[model samples]
Target: MMKQISLMITSVALTFAMNICAQQSPWDKADAIVQSLDPVTFPDKTYVITDFGAVGDGKTLCKEAFEKAITICSDNGGGKITVPAGTYYMNGPLVFKSNVNVHLEKGAILDFSTNESDYLPAVITRWEGTELFNYSPLIYAYHVQNIALTGEGTVNGNGSKKFSPWNNIQTVEQEMLRKMGRTNVPVYRRIFGEGYKLRPGFIEPFGCANVRIEGVTIMDSPFWVIHPIFCNNVIVRNVTVDSHNYNNDGCDPESCRNVLIEGCTFSTGDDAIAIKSGRDNDAWRIGQPTENVVIRNCSFRSKINGVCIGSEIAGGVRNIFIENITIPKSSNAIYFKSNLDRGAYIQDVYVRNVQADTVRTALIRFEPNYKGERSAFHPTLFDSFLIENVTCKQSNECGIYMAGFAERPLQNIVLKNVTIGKVPTPYCFQNGENIRFQSVKVNGKKLDEKPTPKELVKLRVL
Candidate 1:
């Protein structure tokens, strides 16, 4: 009898251990993804821009010198193009070649010219999710592999003086572009440069692999600051962005896979980090989803969202993990927005360990009717979100807000250990199923039950 009891106890212990091992933390996959990434490294050869007849007087145009140096470095099989201290004026874009690392030493600045003519001779680029021939991005790369932009230096776009004013006039052209996208127009014919006012991104690497942008200070971006489109195995680390111009989102990773963004600081006019795929028919044609992204240890003080997932997510997005975020001030702490015209699935997102103060809107929000633009009948499926261990000091609006389409409601969302200190309203939810809250507190009151119909606020389109 004693032997049988001991055997039973051992069996129970073994079963418990097996169950624990089976229920691994979701971050284990994140760790494996990080381990799978390959760090970008260049050859030991260093080509100094000064030696190539580039003047750093902040007045002379060094476009030719840059072109010459980059070409030579690239021809020599791969190396570092080093820029020493001083301000270097660039009249044109810095078009990158494969296997080149642009390293800027401390106190160095690459000041881009504001003249639109400097960016003439349009390049094949994507503008706001639609493929077009447009002015080249300030730092542009296409189909390059193993590229990097690193150093403790500043890249000044000088955009507020020139491109910020164009935002007021871009509405008509913007609508035209969206219409073209909705109509499935061929990407080759969508040309808008020279006379068009659509602003270009600051740093864009399109269709590249194994890219890195680290330790750089970006400022005065006309549009999105650091945008990587259709890229794979990219890393953006230890970067600082302080651009407050219109549409100057700090970083946007669009249609990318296996991306890692960490140790970044942002003070932006828009979202600190916005993940996007493509838009409308253009997205459907491409059929690429943004997936396997990890963002952590970031600080934000934004005029808009702290971390956002699209108003341009027509292509699907999945398997995103975000943690250890601090938001001193923002319009919203966490936001997810999509519209009826965007037909895709955004699922399997995990967020934790976030702290925010002075949120102007809700701490967390899900809006399926974003912008109220219904050019098509396709509706996005918003599902499978797990948000936990989030705390907010105060919110000007409600604590949590959700609005989903009746046809395709938000599904399988779980919030655990979330607390909001002060808010006028606690929650506003509509058309969401399998939405659960555990240990959730708002306005110092525990939300133990589903909100009543009378408590649901009308949808206020942002």
Candidate 2:
């Protein structure tokens, strides 16, 4: 009888905690969205690439074999194209068809050539939110539904010498694209390829639906490692990404909906996962918000932010949930960044059950003043952000740092059940309203007016 009573008490406590979490936002709708997302399904057929005269010795270019396999599979009502073990050197991008799955067996490596000329005859894609005909991503799928890339094999970008060197020459191209983005230049006219210094992403699915990328080891990406733009019902599960180039973000879901990124490990030079919409005028024109995104059970070791909301959030971001995440070595665990040029609303974001170990800079950071070119659409709204049940082993800076514009201050930001071991600086807040902290601890004590870490260091020296 006592054991039954104890179980009942435990259930009641869990119910109470869930209810408290639900009270702050529309969790039921979010849960519904999550539950409805089904895994991508393929027809019952498989095409082996080696049968199509593909060699896997890592030197012979098998672009024709891959293309033929995809064609055969698509022609036969769409099925999986199997890539068996051994390194298959692809000289160009491989496009996916509807209801197709590219399955790689263990020990199979799909390595793309380093020559920029190989990825010519540019395909329609988005570069930093602007639609254009640019160099194709290493693996690209456009307007395809019910497609997946599933396997234990590696999709190697081979970007160390060839693509990584383009970063130095990208300044001119970057400024040109930004200018085109601001001026609402026609996307067709903004062609960049071949001679252009813009590097292509590793895996990107544009304007697609019902996509899944599972269990693939992505490494040495030229740009954003795995990017899905304007996609719906996307699932990226159990993928491993390790890239340390200029903009080697692990995964970026841009202008997408119903995205689930779970059980992924990331060690990258940029954000582990960045949610973006379009950029500036282009994003405003596309007008699609990146909503219904859930990032859970993930580990991140990044040089920059762990999970970022936006700096290219011109189409707004909403209804996001992040839970059960571990940031072992990142500058910030939860980072929301937007600037004056990004005229979008970032609201209804919740982060919970997060563990931060040696977060090099800050645990929770919100910078509404993320640097960008000024625009008339300035005052973006950031509201209803909640962080709960977070524990940090150490932080070099404050536990929480929020800065908002005076005209459009951040609203209803809540922090609950958070503990930080060594946040030597006070929680900083500016231009905010209704910011609440419940059971928040720093250095095993509740936060109060404390000397900065620098001040403490000076006193110790004295």
Among all windows of 10 consecutive residues in model 1, the one with the lowest summed lDDT is 452-461
lDDT of 2 by residue, 1-462 (tens): 999999999999999999998795555666778899987888889889899988899999899898888878888899998899999999999888888899999999999999888888888888777777889889999898888999999999988879988889899998898888889889888899977989998899999999999999999999989999999999999999999988888999999999999999999988898899978888989899999998889999999888888788889999999999999898888888888888788999988999989877678887776754465647679989888999999988677877777788888988888899887774677777788887889888885433222211111000
Q: Write the per-residue lDDT of candidate 1 for residues 234-310, one digit (tens) a residue.
A: 99999999999998899889999999999999999988989999888889889899999999999988998999998
Best by TM-score: 1
What is the model-wide C-alpha lDDT for candidate 2? 0.86
Which candidate leads in lDDT? 1
lDDT of each: 0.90, 0.86
Per-residue lDDT for 157 in model 1? 96
Give the TM-score of each candidate: 0.94, 0.91
